[model samples]
Target: MPCLLLAAGRGERMRPLTDTTPKPLLQIQGKSLLQWHIEALVAANARRIVINHAWLGEQIELALGDGAKWGAQIQYSSEETALETAGGIRKALALLNPEPYFLVINGDVFCPGFPIAAFTSRFQAQLSNGNKLLAYLALVLNPPQHPDGDFYLHGEQVNDKPRDADFEERKLTFSGIGIYHQSLFADLKLGEAVKLAPLLRSAMAKNQVFGEKYAGPWHDVGTPQRLYELNQSYDPK
Candidate 1:
């Protein structure tokens, strides 16, 4: 399996700071977000990665060259304008993520503890079961900022149906970490922008979307306040 780093957004919510630097290039502690992910993925023995960039994209290429420093091979997919998630994936389909399943991540986040090796087990199971789309969503307990929550979890499946009095409140936020089968993007056309929500909803409707609760600390790392917070708290050993 391969990985795709979704790095192309312009960071509208993250204003003035983003005016100069790409969000992924923003520092958390001493390391850049992109650098941290690169090192972690390489540690997981994930040797190939595809990164799509649009805003301040050129600098990303300059900062992380062929991935030799991190022991991985990197390829870039350029988007003149920010293409929502689906379009970025579609653009990079050929060079990377050509296989059955691949991991996709938002570049602007800090997800140091996300387990990359777990996919090996999931991939084997999907192979045997002939599963078409197996998305391993990273779920989080609701935060004060996002009280509504993103989805509900039933085993590994992500259900849109809110919790009822009869069911346990399995409120979970999409950790921005997910594994996707190439088949998930099957209907997506090339050369067009597409958001991932509707597509995932379609899969969820079919019970093909799965999720996992991640207790580890993950940050959206948006807004100036968040940037200051991460810079103050980030530590890697």
Candidate 2:
């Protein structure tokens, strides 16, 4: 499956650091967040990677040209204004519209390892059932900074259940990682500033949104403090 890395956010929360360098270019343990993602994706044998850029976008292109160094080909989706996650994906669909299903991820998140086989297996199986799955969300424990959390996990589904109170407590934050089928945004007008939460919620109502719990080291890396913390965690003895 092709991969689309959403790196166009202005990252308002990560100022000072983001004041100079793009957030995805910020290094964690000597490798840029974008580089680390490229490495992992290549190892998983994902060849075509689409990266979207907005603020300080030139740096991203200058730093990782063509993605050849990482054994992958890169296509950039340059957003003049930082489009929210869904908007970016919608814009890049023409470039990487991975036929049946593909993966999308945040460029700023720092997760050291991702299980590619597990994701591929589930994706293929879900497609065999003749169903149009919207997204296969990866959920994780809520971080200390945002305890309210993002979504609910009932079995393998990730979504909202306003009908039940217990479902609210099943709060699990999105890992900023997901698989997207072209059909998910079939009705979307490209470049429209739209958040995907509503579309995902609609999918959830039909039990089409599947999820997996990944207990791994993942940092939001959206603020200077978070960046510092990640750098310290990767500090070598």
Candidate 3:
């Protein structure tokens, strides 16, 4: 399946740093965060990459070029303004091929050990079995920045409703990594800004969304402080 890397957000939280550079171009260890994701995807043999950029979009093009150096085919989906998540995916759908399912990752996130091949195999199996999942999210333990978390996971399914007061089920954060079916965005209007949560929630109501908890090295590199800490501790190799 083709992959879409979301690199368009104007990093308002990073302020001065993002004033001159896009968040994906921010350095982590010795390499740019976007480069890390690109390398990881390349390693996974996902050579056809579609990146959507809005803030500093040209720089991203200049930095990565045709992706030949990385042994991948790169395509750009330039946006004049940030189109949010769902909208960006909708806009870039054509470049993602005719596959019913494709991978999408947030450009700002840093997940070093994501098992892409394994996840892809599982997703393929689920689809082959005739299951109708609009999307399957990779959930993670809540970080300090978002302690309450986003959704509740029961078994391998996701639900919009929070767990009961008993706290038997733990709420987890959306890791920003997911495999989505094209049908999920079939009703969306192109070029409009639309957040993904509402769409996922709507699908969850019909039991069309699934999830799995991934307990691994993952960080939301939203702020400079987090980036600094990650650089200090992480060895990208």
Candidate 4:
């Protein structure tokens, strides 16, 4: 399956640092954020990658080139204006079309050494079981910045609302890592700017969305302080 890395946001919260450099180009532990994901993905043997960028998009192209350095085939889905997650994915559907399902990661978040292959396996396993899931999200403990959380996860099912029954359900923050079927965005028109949450919520209502909590070091890295903290704590080992 192919992977799409979202890198088009203007990074308004990141301010001056992003004024000249795209958010994904911001470095932590001596590697650009985008590079971290690339290295991890390539290490997992996932070689087809599609990166979408708008702000300073060319710089990303210049830096990563053709992905030869990492032995991957990198393609760019350039946008004149930044498209929100769903829109970006919809626009890049052509590149991701060969595969019924593809992986999508938010370019700004930092989660080093994520188990991409494992998640792929889980997704495939579910598919083989004959479940028609449209999306599989990797959820994480809510960060301080987003304590309210995004979605509720009960067992392997993700829901927009908590169930009234007795089973355990915990609301968690979206780690911005997910595997999606191409059909999730089939209703979206190409180039229409749309956020991903609504679509996921819609899928959740139909019980088509599933999630697994990722108990790993993860950071949203939306601000400079968050980036600095991550770098300061990084052991580089």
User: Which residue segments of model 2 deviate by more than 4 Å?
Assistant: 129-132, 162-168, 235-237
Position 43, candidate 1: lDDT: 82
lDDT of 1 by residue, 1-237 (tens): 788988999988888888999988888777888888888888889889999999999999999998998899999999999879988888888878466778888898888877777755664575577665557677887766777888889876787886477856756778778888788777788868999888888888888887677787787887889889777777765
**lDDT (CA) per prediction:** 0.82, 0.85, 0.91, 0.92
**What is candidate 3's lDDT per residue for 1-237, written digit by digit as tens?**
899999999999998899999999999877888888899899999989999999989999999998999998999999999999999999999889746889999999999879988888887777787878999999999999999899999877888686577676668999999999999999999999899999999999999998788998999998989999998989756
RMSD of each: 1.9, 1.9, 1.3, 1.3
TM-score for all models, in order of appearance: 0.92, 0.93, 0.96, 0.97
Which ranges in model 3 have alpha carbons more than 4 Å from their true place?
163-168
Error of 4 at 199 (Å): 0.8
Report the backbone clash tally of model 4. 0
Instruction: Count backbone overlaps in model 2.
Output: 0
Each model's total of backbone clashes = 0, 0, 0, 0
- Global lDDT for candidate 3? 0.91
Q: If the candidates were sorted by their TM-score against the true structure, best first, what order would they fall in?
A: 4, 3, 2, 1
Q: Is candidate 3 or candidate 4 better by lDDT?
A: 4
Supply the global lDDT for candidate 4. 0.92
User: Model 4, poorest ten-residue lDDT window?
Assistant: 162-171
